[model samples]
Target: MKPKFITISDSIIKKIKSGELIPGDKIPSENELIKNYKISNTTARKTLLEIESKGWVRRIKGKGTFVLNRTATHQLVRTLGSIDSTRKGFNESLKAEGLTPKNIILEKTILNEGVSAAIVGRHVIIEGPVLKVHQLRYADDELMKDETRYISLTLCPKIDALSTEISYFKAYEQQYNLKINDIRQTLSADILEANSNKNHFGTTSNIAIFVLDSAVFADDGKVIEIEYSYYRGDKYKFAISAHPEYGHKSDD
Candidate 1:
C-alpha cells in the first residue's frame, strides 16, 4: 500500500486538477485534515507540506494554506542527468505546461585576450580561445533563466559566425562531428534581490533562484563548453531518476 501521506497528498492534487480546489482557495487546516481523514497530526502536517513542496499551495502564517496562480507560480519541471534527455527537454516541458518558451542572446563575444593555458585544466577543459554567449530565457513571457555559455573555439572554430537561433548541440554533432558524451553539473540555491546587479529580471526581486554550473564534454573526452545558468525557482523545478548506484543513501 502507498504511504498515507502520499495518498492524502494525491487526493488533494486530484481536487486541484479537477478545479475543485483552485487558486486562492484555502486548503484544509491541519486540524481539519486530521479530523476529516482520521490521520495523526504529523501525517496531516506532512500532507500539507508535501502539497506545498509540489507548488500547489501557499501557507500564510496563521492564515491557513491558500492556492496560488499556478500559471504564474507553476513550476516547470525538467529531468536532470537523464541520458536520453537533452536541452530540448526543457522547451518541451514548457510547451507541455501550456507555456511558450523563448531565449534571447543578450551578448556574444570573443575572449582572445584572456586565452591562456592555465584555465584549460580548471574552469574549461579546452585549450584555446572561447566564445561567450549570454542569454535571457523566458517562459510564458516571464523571465525564467539567465544563462551564459562559454564554448571552446578550439573545438568549434567559427561557431560564433552561426545564426543566433542555431542550436550549439546540433552544430557539435553535424558541423564539428562531435558527439556529446556527458555533462558534469552542480546545482545550488540562493536568493536574489529584486535589484540584483545583473538586473536580469525586472519584475521580480528577493526570489529564490537556482544556480547551475556545468561543463559539456564530447565523446573524445574533451570539453565542448562551460555554462552558468540561473533559473528562477518559482518558474522551474528539477526531477531526476536514479538507481541504487546514483542515489544518495539516507543517514537515517
Candidate 2:
C-alpha cells in the first residue's frame, strides 16, 4: 500500500487535474490536512512537499500553499542575444502579461572534464573547473522551463560561490568585471514521455518540448558559458519577426 502522505498528496493532485482547484487557489493548510486526513504534522508537511515537488503547487513563507497553472500558455520572442538577455526579455514579457516571474535554483555542482566535454561541446577545451547550474523557471507561479548552464570557472573564479538566483551577466559584470560579447544559439523540439516527466512538469506522456542550446563568448573571444534548456510545448508560443533589409527581398 502507498504511504499515507503519498495517498493524501495524490488525492489533492487529482482535484488539481480536474480543475476543481484552480490556479492561485490555496490548498489545505498543514493543520487542516492533519485534521481532515487524521495524519500527523510530519505526514501533512510531507504531503505538501510532495505536491510542490511535482510542480502542482507553490508554498509562500508565512502565506500559504497555492495551486499553480501547470498548463498556462506563455510566449517566447526569439532575438539575437545571450541567455541573460533572453531571460530579461521573458521577465518583462511576463510582467506585461500581468504574470509574476520567478527563477529557482535547483542544483549546482562542479562538472568533471568528461561530463563537461559531452554537454559543453567537444570542441571546447576544458582548461579549468566547470560549474553546472540547474534552474527551474516559472511565470505566474507556473513552471515553464528547466535550464542547465555550464560556466567556465577559469573565466570567473567566484561564480561557483555565488547564488544561482542572481542574473549571471550582472554577477559577472559586478564581481568579475567581465562582459559577454556574443552568443550562438540553436532551437529544436522533442516529444517527451508523460510518465517520465509527470513529476518534473506535472503533465502526462508524449508531451512536446522545445530545446535551446547556447554558447556564450566574452569580448576577448573566449567562451564563457554554455546552456541547455527545455521549455514545455503546451505552455509556450514562439514569435519571430524579420526585416527585408536584413534578409531576402520583400514580396511587394
Candidate 3:
C-alpha cells in the first residue's frame, strides 16, 4: 500500500490537473492537511516537499505554498500550401487567444558557399552566398520559439538590407514579386540544455523542444530558403494532415 503522504500528494495533484486548483492559488496548509487527511505533521510536510520537488507548487517563506503556473498547450495546424502559411497561422492563433505575437532578430550574417551548402544541403547550390537570419519569437511577451532562416542571396539580392521586423515571406512577395510554389518540412523533438543562446526563452536546462526544418521552393522549382526552428515543447502541439490526391498518403 502507498503511504498516507503519497496518497495526499496524489489527491492534490488530481485537483491541480482538473483545474480545481489554479496557479497562484494557495494550497492546503500543513495544519489543514493534517486535519483533512488525518495525517501527522511530518507526513504533511513530506507531502508538500514532494509536490514542490515535482515543480507543481512553490512555498514562500512567509506567504505559504502556491501552485505554479504550468505550461499550457497551443495547437499548431500544418498546412501544405503557401510560403508564409505557418508564420501567418502562428500570428493568427496567438491573436485569437488574446496574446500578442512578437519577434526579435538575434543575428544576421552572410554564409559562404561551403558553409551554406553544409547547413542547408548539398543539393541546394549557392551561386554566391546565403543570408542567415536568427530570430526569437514570443507570444504575450513570453519567448516561445527560436528560428534560423537561410536565404539564397542570388535569388533575393539585397535581402540583408531589409528590416528584420517584417515577415520575410511578405517581403519576398511584395518587394521581389516572387511566387512560392511549395515548402517541404520535417518535424522532430528533443531536449536542449539551457545555454546562453536560449536564455531569452526563460527556460532552465534540459528543456524539451520541438524542431522544424523546412525548405521553401519558388515557382520555378528552385529552393529559395531553408529554415530551422525550435519551439518549446511544453507550450506547443502540432497536427499534420495529408491529402491522398496530392500524392501524399493519408498514413504519412
Candidate 4:
C-alpha cells in the first residue's frame, strides 16, 4: 500500500490537473487538509511538501500553498548530431513543440592562439588550426540556447565556410564523405551566470540552467568536434533514458 501522504498528494495533483485548482489559487491549508482527509497534521504537511518538491505547488508563509504555473513539456533529449546522425535535431525539437526555431551566428573565427589553441590541442585530431563558432538558438524569438562549437580545420576545412543554418553533421557526411562514429556528452544542472551572452539572456534572476558538453568522433576513431551548450532550465525539461543492459554502449 502506498503511504497516506502520497495518496493525499495524488488527490491534490488531480485537482490541479482537472482545473479545479489553478495557478495562484490557494490549495487547502495544512489544517484544512487534516480536516478534509481525517489525516493527522503531520501527514497533511507531508502531503504539501511532496507536491511542492515535484514542482506542482508553492508555499507562501501565512498565504498557504498555491498551484504553480506550468506549460507544455519542451523536453530535448538529442543533439545536432542525432543518435542516428541523420536528423536536424535542435530544429526538429522546437517544431514538435509548435515553436519556430531560429539560430543566430554570433561569431565564427579561426582559432590559432589563446584558449582555443589549448582546446584544439586536447580534442581535435589536428595539432593546430581549429574553427570556433558561437551561435544563439531561439524559440519563437525568445532566446533559449547558447552554443559554442570547435571543429578541426584539418578534418573539415569547409566547416568555416558553411552557412549559419547548415548542420555540421551534414557537412561531415555529405561534403566530406566521412561517417560519424559516435557522440558523447555530459550534462549537469547549473545556474546562468555572468558571461559574454549575459546581455542576450538578461539578468541572472532565473538562475536555473543546464550545461552540456559534447564531443563527436569520426569513423576512424578521431575526435573531430567539441561543443558546449547551455539550455534554459525554466523553459526546458529534459528526459533521458538509460539502458543498463546495454552497458556503456555508444550510439550507433
TM-scores of the candidates are 0.61, 0.57, 0.58, 0.58
* Candidate numbers, best lDDT first, in rank order: 1, 3, 2, 4
Q: What is the lDDT of residue 47 in candidate 2?
A: 100
Q: On residues 19-127, what C-alpha lDDT tens digit does candidate 1 reach at each position?
A: 6664445689999999999999999999999998998887777667766557647565555564334443345434434456787889999887433221223454556
Tens digit of per-residue lDDT, candidate 4, span 223-242? 67777778877776443434
lDDT of 1: 0.71
Residue 112 miss distance in model 4 (angstroms): 2.8
Mind giving the per-residue lDDT tens digits that candidate 3 earns over 164-194? 6566776676788877665566678887877
Question: Which regions of candidate 2 are displaced past 4 Å?
Answer: 1-72, 78-84, 87-97, 112-122, 197-199, 239-252
Q: Which of candidates 1 and 3 is the stronger one according to lDDT?
A: 1
TM-score of 2: 0.57
Please tell me which model should have the higher TM-score, number 2 or number 3. Answer: 3
lDDT for 164 in candidate 3 is 69
Q: What is the lDDT of residue 101 in candidate 1?
A: 72
Better of 2 and 4 by TM-score: 4
Per-model tally of clashing residue pairs: 1, 3, 0, 0
TM-score of 4: 0.58
lDDT value, candidate 2, whole model: 0.69
